[model samples]
Target chain A: MSLRLQARKLACERDDRWLFRGLDLDIRAGEIVRVEGPNGSGKTTLLKILSGQLADYHGELFWNEAPMRRSRKAFLANLLYLGHSPGVKAALTPLENLAWYQALAGEPDDAAARLEALASVGLVGFEEVPAGQLSAGQQRRVALARLTLIPRPLWVLDEPFTAIDRDGVVALEARLSAHARQGGCVLVTTHHALAASSALRRIRLGQGGDDAGA
Target chain B: MPGPDASPVSEQQAGVACREPREGTAVAVRATLKRDLVLMLRRRSEVLNPLVFFALVITLFPIGISPDPALLASIAPGLLWVAALLAALLSLDSLFRSDFEDGSLEQLLLSPQPLPALVLAKVAVHWLLTGLPLALMAPVLGIMLSLPAGSYAVLALSLALGSASLSLIGAIGAALIVGLSRGGVLLSLLVLPLYIPVLIFGAGAVQAAILGAGVAAHLAILGALLAVALMFAPWAIAASLRISING
Candidate 1:
């Protein structure tokens, strides 16, 4: 299987403020790499860099050995990154939101199936209602609905469990575990420990030493 | 539902699965335009605000400044064009703000389609909402201004080209300032100066028509500005959006 993510000497900065420097990491197929760190530790920045959202960072990030900086669309097409914000438009119905997302992700005709995915995420009766009217957890679930499609090979989740209820968190863990079991990779940053049976590895950032251990 | 032909069934299902990743440019552009148009239509207020602003500004001149038919007729073209520009700028702040706030902008950035194409779709919808309506309403306002019968053609033509350019160029400012909260007023301040050339040519075309110098030169300039913006604004807007979004 191809290497899912490979970062070499990755460095990131914002507003002349150095966030991370000379960091290297890798995740292979069927792997779950959790990035643990305190707030302002640049976890989200690192995820954005790895996911090909920020290109000004130093060093190299490769998805399937292709430089992520050069061809982001191919890289992004193979991965899904859920940031802190759920990213759903409030005025658009859940189905409409998913349908637009599918099209933007280049999956226009998949609205019917996308609606099914939305339903699986507990957005059943509210499928046609604008996402803004839904509760916070429901909106997050609307974003999570994209995971059920499974077209992408890698999932980079930043604080996915934020605002999720206890049951929802368990369901998410199971989904992540199943994704890894199916030879997919997941790079996630979360405050809570994810309990799963998969071969999980943790990378704790922002420590005094180079403390990279599984 | 299982049967001896389950293998074929599974193969067909694989071929026709939902949630599959999309992978083309033209298809993506079409889909994006459709989505944007639908959103613009549903949010009727956003579409009408600029038009109303145009009419209000046009009406304000006759009430606050002067109702003298001679003066209104002479200044109508300039007032109408200027008002339309301001009105368009008024609505441009929402071009990306709502999307950026709701995370839809990030999804658009993640799309496999080129960012410029997505930006074009957005600009197109903006033109439909803000620019197109103002263009249609120019003649009505022209009559109010007592615009010479001969200059009405030039007035309408200049507005069409001029507002299209305004939408395109305003999109650049909108994308740049979207990262900042309360970007609406600041966006106008930033984009208004940039619209000087369009406003110049747009109003000049009408003035020339009344002066019997032929409106061709001004119309051509307005068209040229529109072309220049069409060529460059998308790339600029897309790049700016990426910077603000990732920052």
Candidate 2:
């Protein structure tokens, strides 16, 4: 419950274009920060940098008090990063996918409870179907199903609600809210405005860098 | 290295009561073999397709070249081995392409199990599917090429060992080129040279056996190549894959 994600003078580039520069941000436990920006404004890149997935950026990112460069794997192990792609294997059933993902995350929790978590995401009846056959929204639901079993404290999501239907989006918001209420921290990027039930903070990536706009 | 079960829960959360289980390299290797076997079974056609291609290429050689038995026998080992190498190369694209495209590769990268272990499992699977079947089929095709029975064992053994080396080495190439446009042809260009050592020794083994010379030396070379690839390719390929995905 003592996790802290902070960045100072962080700058990033994608394909030689400066996406963001000289950005500073801080989020402690119990804060849900939302990153909103225009298309191709580097919301995803910033999330990846924060999640330790992309590390070739300039300036500093600190997890707790240590430099992110020194403790990357340790940092990544505690962060759950869900990109625009749900990252579910299409050939495997939803249940099978979740089982493997839970193992990948090094969670040793009960598989039965994992299945129950899938059910919690309203994927009970479709658990046996391969994800390739599922609709886009359903596939997303299966990906989000990981939240039920894994216990990582930080969730970094990029456009997490993209393909989810209206009802699915609402359900996901509730899950994010519950996660934050339980002393977890979330950093997400989205185009759609999230409802106010969750105490979600906001950070908008403008033409310059991350600041309090939009 | 510690086993998957022995991995610490957290960097700082050590000194817990229970001792973590340690799965050694042997268990990791066995688990890898099992997973590869299952994947091969599920994709049976993909496994056999390369063998069929190998057989087809050998079949064409007889019609494309002289049908005389002596002439065909003289070059059969090298021809069949080259065709098999190319066939293996043709299917290398499928090794990580599907998984990468479907997003499964990302999940694998995130796995607590070492990425190298998972990559070794994948390379093993590729060898089982594409390389092993070609080795098994080479003996049957060798007869059509008029390869002597005495040399057939050498051919099969060399191919079995050598094609495995190809898969391991090719994995690095495949991973490096996974996300690029026109990657398949580029991959061939990158890996085909690396495959030459395996080919030279594999075909040379059978050729030496045909000459009534000691084929053991040639077979030993192929085995050494396989061993080297087995030791290094997994780590290199895993690193290249991470770089490619992150890029």
Candidate 3:
């Protein structure tokens, strides 16, 4: 549980409008940071920049005190990002989808638990079914299945509660708390309130303050 | 299937499975290749369409032009090369489309593995399913075109080598426009110009062989083009993917 990520003077302007400017932020392990803002407030853009997916913004990002630009591979190695879209292949079954992601993770040992992870997400017999045929909630569960199977230290989740059910929401909240407690961290953006008990920090955008949450 | 005792995954089992020693690039490449092959094979119709297009277009040339054997023979090299090139382009749109749509492309960009290596795997799968089949299928079309007696093997050889370069070049355009919902026309506009060198050399190989000249120089140049593409296209593809996704 140490200072894991830091951003300095991060500013993003899209279409001649400033989303956030002169923003400084620090994130440590064993913490859950929630990014909240009105729609078009650059919440998703911020998460994408942190995850190294979008590079159109102006900022400095650091992972473990090293500039992310220099250690991008290291940053990506420790990161897992789940966007609004579930990233599930329609042609691949749930098991197959998880299996392909497992390959990208580059760890072959924990693959045996993929079925159990799907089951935990309430996708019991749907393991062999094509993800496209599943409901949107089920498809989100397929992407969420990675939370259990892939053991990354940092997670950047965008609207993770969308299309998910009540039981799923509770289970995901519990997972997030457990992860924070285990020296891992998460930076999540959602309209739905998270019930994770402690270590929850809220950072509201459009206010021009990086530590607006604390 | 999970046994009855499978519980919600224990986050505290930190000692269990986080030893992520970077597996070699070859391992990532194999996994990507196998994943794409399985996906392309399951969508069998998409895989078959390009070869079918090649045959149908070759069949139309005789009806559209002339049925005279001598006339067809004189133009067969260009005819076969153009048709095969179009078939390869027809299938190129899918090279990164589905993955881009599904957000798998984002996952790929974030993989700790080399992006170029993984992209090369995907392009290799494209050639295996589309280009290789088109090359194998060209000789049959060569017969339909009344291609000269000894030039059949040369036609196949040239196409097989030439189409590898085609897949590589076409992939660059596919990557650039993958973000567009309707990139088919834009892709052709971007890729067709780059395809000219391959078209010239590919048709020239068969033409040289048909003319009873040394086909070695033409084939060597095609191989050289493939080598250059193999060296650089993946990096371009990876960069373009980032751009498309970011934009």
**DockQ values, each candidate:** 0.33, 0.22, 0.44
lDDT per residue as tens, model 1, B1-247: 1122321333223322222335677777877788788888888998989888888888778888887889998888789888898888888888998888877787788777789988998899899878888998999988877888898778888898999999998998999898998777788888889999999899999999988897888998898899999999999999989888766
Best by the lDDT measure: 3
Over A41-85, each residue of candidate 1 has an lDDT whose tens digit, in order, gives 778888887877777788887766767766566566677778889
TM value for model 1: 0.91
For residues B129-237, write the lDDT of model 3, one tens digit per residue. Answer: 9989998999999999999989988899899999999999899999999999999999999999999999999999999999999999999999999999999999999
Assess the local accuracy of residue A130 in candidate 2 as a C-alpha lDDT between 0 and 100.
73
TM-scores of the candidates in the order shown: 0.91, 0.90, 0.95
Q: Per-residue lDDT tens digits of candidate 3, residues A25-104?
A: 89888789999998989899889988888787777988879898887876777888998788999989999888878888
Model 2: per-residue lDDT, tens digit, B123-189? 9888877888889899999999898879888888899999999999999999999878579889999
Clashes of each: 2, 0, 1
Residue B216, candidate 3: Cα error in Å is 1.0
Which regions in candidate 3 have their CA more than 4 angstroms from the true location? A1-3, A109-111, A207-213, B1-21
Residue-by-residue lDDT tens digits, candidate 2, A1-214: 2678889878887787778887788877666899977988888888877887676788798877888877566665667778788877676778767766665665553679667768767787897887789999888888787765666777888888878887778777776776666567788899888876546888778765445422
Instruction: Let me know the TM-score candidate 3 reaches against the reference structure.
Output: 0.95
TM-score of 2: 0.90
Greater lDDT among 1 and 2 belongs to 1
CA lDDT scores, all candidates in order: 0.79, 0.78, 0.86
